[model samples]
Structures are given as structure tokens and as C-alpha cells.
Target: MILKIGKLFIAAVIFTGISALAVSAFAASGPALFRSEGCIACHTIDGHGGSVGPNLSHIGSQRSLSWIKTQIVTPGAHFASGSTVTINGKSYMAIMPNHKNMPASDVNTIAQYLESLK
Candidate 1:
């Protein structure tokens, strides 16, 4: 019984260490992914980027994390594709591509990063 308990404790410790590493990686990758994933091409943050999509400088202040995730994975859920949507007094076409095939980890990381903007 003591040996089993010891093994279980060791297993738990390893799992915790791995989990911490994963969380750290997730937290660190968001900004990089945002840039590498071509988000900068259409969204502006901190006064940099293109004008194709709505500026995301204060997206976190305006949107929830879950909402951002949904927008990333399935933007059509919020707005019909090819339709015009108004945001912050500006008109924009709902042209953001759907990322349904993107890895969930990337989506979560991006959402968390955007949610932390505020």
C-alpha cells in the first residue's frame, strides 16, 4: 500500500510539472501565433497592422474570451459571411475566414491573449 501511494505521488508530480509547462507554452505562444497566423494582416493592435478587419486594439475590453474564441473558430456564427457588420461606428464586411480546422490550443492561446488586452 505504501509503495502504491509513493508511485501515485510521483505520477502526480510528473503530471503537474507537464501541465505547468503546457500552460506556460500556451501563454507564451499567443502573441507569436497572432503574428505568424497572419492576424496582423487585417487587425491592428497598439497602432500597428492593416485596415482590412476591425481593429482589435481593445477587443478584450469589448469581447469575452469565449466570444473571441468563437469568432476565431467560427465567425459566421456571429455574422453571416459576405454581410456587412458595424463595429465601433465603422462598417466592415464579415470577411474574416473561419478557422474551424485550427488547433484548439492555438485558439485558446489567441483567445487568452486577446482577453488579456484589457
Candidate 2:
């Protein structure tokens, strides 16, 4: 009976270790991909980053994968039209560069990573 219990414990430990390794690999990839894509320049996450774009500290919780994917693929479409900022008492059109041309797969990866942030 003890031998059977020992075997079960060993299996559980091995499973846990494998799961940990997988999570570590995923975590590493997310940040690495984020840097490679230049997202760090415009967005602040976890209370650190630039101020040019909206805070993404909890974007994962707010946006679904499909919504996130669309934003990445067509950045301009997701944002509201027309510039709300006033310059010289005149409304200036908000300018957000389009990312529609970026590869869908890469954007999907980014979206997945962002969704997992929380």
C-alpha cells in the first residue's frame, strides 16, 4: 500500500514540475515578444512604461481575445474617430497609426499574451 502511495506522489510531483516549466516558458515568451514588437514604447503596463498610450495594466481582464486581436490588426478602427484633444481651441483629429498590415499570426500572439497578463 505504501509503495502505491509513493508512486502516486512521484507522478503528482512530476506533473507539477512539467506544468511549472510550461508556464515559465510561456511567461518568457510573452515579454520577449512584447519587446520585439515595440509595444513597450507606447503602452505602460504594471504601473511602468510610457504615457503616449492608454494604460494596459489590466487590459487582459477588460478585453477579450477577439477584441484585442482586432485592435492589434486594425488599431485605427478600435479607437474613436476624430481628435478630442483641442489645440488652439480647435479640435484636432486624434492620430493613431494603423497596424492592419501586421501579420495576423503575430498579432494573435500579442493578443494572447496580453489576455494572459492578468
Candidate 3:
């Protein structure tokens, strides 16, 4: 009985450690992936990035996680009519380019990060 209890405790500890590591890795990757994927070229996080796209400092407050994910994965599908994205003080009629080629995992990571901004 003692041995079984010890084994269970060890298993729980291992599971917790793995979970923590996974969360840490995703947290680290989210911002890095956003930058490496060139999102900064068009979007701003806190008025510090490019002005080609809309400022995304409060995007999480305006969008849901699933919506953000869909936008990332199939940007054209959502903006077929070519909506206008205002940057700084200028509005440009443009369609967000499709990122369907990006891996699903990376998309999800980015979505999660964006969702956390609120």
C-alpha cells in the first residue's frame, strides 16, 4: 500500500512538471512566433509596431479565441470583401493575407497569445 501511494505521488509530480513545462514553452513561443512570422510588419501590440494593419493592443477584448484563430488560418475567408484596416490615422482597403500555410500548432499558439492580451 505504501509503495503504491509513493508511485502515485511520483506520477502526479511528473505530470505536474510536464504540464508546467508545456505551458512555459507555449508562453515563450507565442510572442516569438508572432515576431518571427512577421506580424510586427503590419500590426502593433502597444503602439510600437508598424502601421500597415490595425493596432492589436486590445484585439483580445474585441475578438474571441476561435475568431482570432480563424482569422489567422483563413484570413481571406473572413475578409472576402476586402475590409478596411485603419492604422494610425489612415484607412486602407486591404484583405488580410491567408496564412493557411502556417502550421496549425503555431496558429493556435498565436491565437492563445492574442487572447491573453485582454
TM-score comparison, 1 vs 3, better candidate: 1
* Lowest lDDT 10-residue stretch of candidate 2: 85-94
Report model 1's TM-score to 2 decimal places: 0.78
lDDT per residue as tens, model 3, 1-118: 9999999999999999999999886654877888999888888897667866777888888889999999898876665547775545678667567788998889998999999887
Error of 2 at 47 (Å): 3.2
Q: Candidate 2: deviation at residue 77, Å?
A: 1.7
Superposed Cα deviation of residue 14, candidate 2 (Å): 23
Runs of candidate 3 exceeding 4 Å displacement: 1-28, 81-90
Q: Give residue 17's error in model 2 in angstroms.
A: 20
Best by TM-score: 1
**Model 1 regions lying over 4 Å from their true place:** 1-28
Worst 10 residues of 1 by lDDT: 23-32
CA lDDT of each prediction against the hidden true structure: 0.92, 0.72, 0.82
C-alpha TM-score for every candidate: 0.78, 0.60, 0.69
Model 2 C-alpha lDDT per residue in residues 31-66, reported as the tens digit of each score: 666677777777778876765566677778878999
The alpha-carbon deviation from the true structure for residue 23 of candidate 2, after best TM-score superposition, in angstroms, is: 17
TM-score of 3: 0.69
